[model samples]
Target: MEHVAKTRDRITLTGVRVRAHHGVFDFEREAGQEFVIDVSVAVDLAAAASGDDLARTVHYGELAEAISAAVERDPVDLIETVAERVASVALAFPAVEEVEVTVHKPQAPITVPFTDVAVTIVRGRA
Candidate 1:
């Protein structure tokens, strides 16, 4: 008989863009800015695979809401802070083993015109 190998599944939510006030400049808070978020979570899918239940899987909508809430609730000076907050929230889920969050700012007020600026962070169970 041949043995089957078990593998973990990863869930990802990408391009979750939200306009918020997150920047080092005062105008960022007063006028607000546009930001984008991307999140990836690694989870154990054995139970969800066998059970076929939504509860067994990570709810991306909830994750997006959480991220949005965090960003909107607090004003930060850097995208690094935003990334950290997003990763921390994603890792709060029991099923999530690892999380990666990226925050993108396309309209950053820079002296030189560029495509975009972003910050990425990865967090896992310790």
Candidate 2:
């Protein structure tokens, strides 16, 4: 079987804010924290653009909701796990050929002052 390249067209959702309890320290998880996420999906836009049908493409609203739900679930020790979970969620959409997920934890428990901590992952269909 021949493999087709994914379309360059990308649909992105940024700054998806959610509060979840994910951390290694007991206090950290007990207090909970805010996580910001960004997601991008690559898919063929010809059908959706030409036909103007919602069924032909992945819905941004639905995608955001899915990401939010995924993050708000059970706690994990690392943002890497969250990123992987989000990538899996994005790949579940039939039209998504490739997905990039970024999970950010701004309020991480660091002794030194820092701006943010994040993990990014890219996944594609086989």
Candidate 3:
């Protein structure tokens, strides 16, 4: 069984679309495709809520751009790596305690028909 992170105030960015080259096949690497990324970051928002200060919380706009850049920055062979990379970025925020990332590959090359394929991972500080 996998461990689930404890509940906390979350900032979710879903359906963030980015085009990238990531796959095991040569064609997949050469011909990039669109990837939809979903990220949920767990952080302490009590200060921000009480103080009404943006500085006390994670900025969703900046975080979304950071996640997108991580996805489009390098060409990896697996979405699992991409998910980990996103999680790492999220965990860098001072207020973030845990992160969950989902990398969606809609144009995967498979013989049979499929809607999508993805990898979801959860990570936190050690």
Clashes of each: 0, 0, 0
Better of 1 and 2 by TM-score: 2
Model 3 agreement with the true structure over 13-126: per-residue lDDT tens digits: 999999999999999899999999999998888899999999999999999999999999889999999999999999998889989999999999888999999999999889
Candidate with top lDDT is: 2
Worst lDDT run of 10 residues, candidate 1, spans 4-13
What's the lDDT for all of these models? 0.85, 0.94, 0.92
Q: Candidate 2 residues 1-126, lDDT tens each?
A: 999665899999999999999999998689999999999999888999999988999999999999999999999999999999999999999999999999999999888999998989999988
Candidate 1 local lDDT, residue 16: 90
Of 1 and 3, which scores higher on TM-score? 3
Q: What residue runs in model 1 are displaced by over 4 Å at the alpha carbon?
A: 1-8
Q: After superposition, how far is residue 64 of candidate 1 from its true place, in Å?
A: 1.2
What is the model-wide C-alpha lDDT for candidate 1? 0.85
Ranking by TM-score: 2, 3, 1
Rank by lDDT (best first): 2, 3, 1
TM-score of 3: 0.93
Tens-place lDDT per residue, model 1, 1-126, is 999443358888888988888888998889997788889898878788799977887887898898888777688898998888888889888788889898999999988979998888889878
Local distance difference test, candidate 3: 0.92
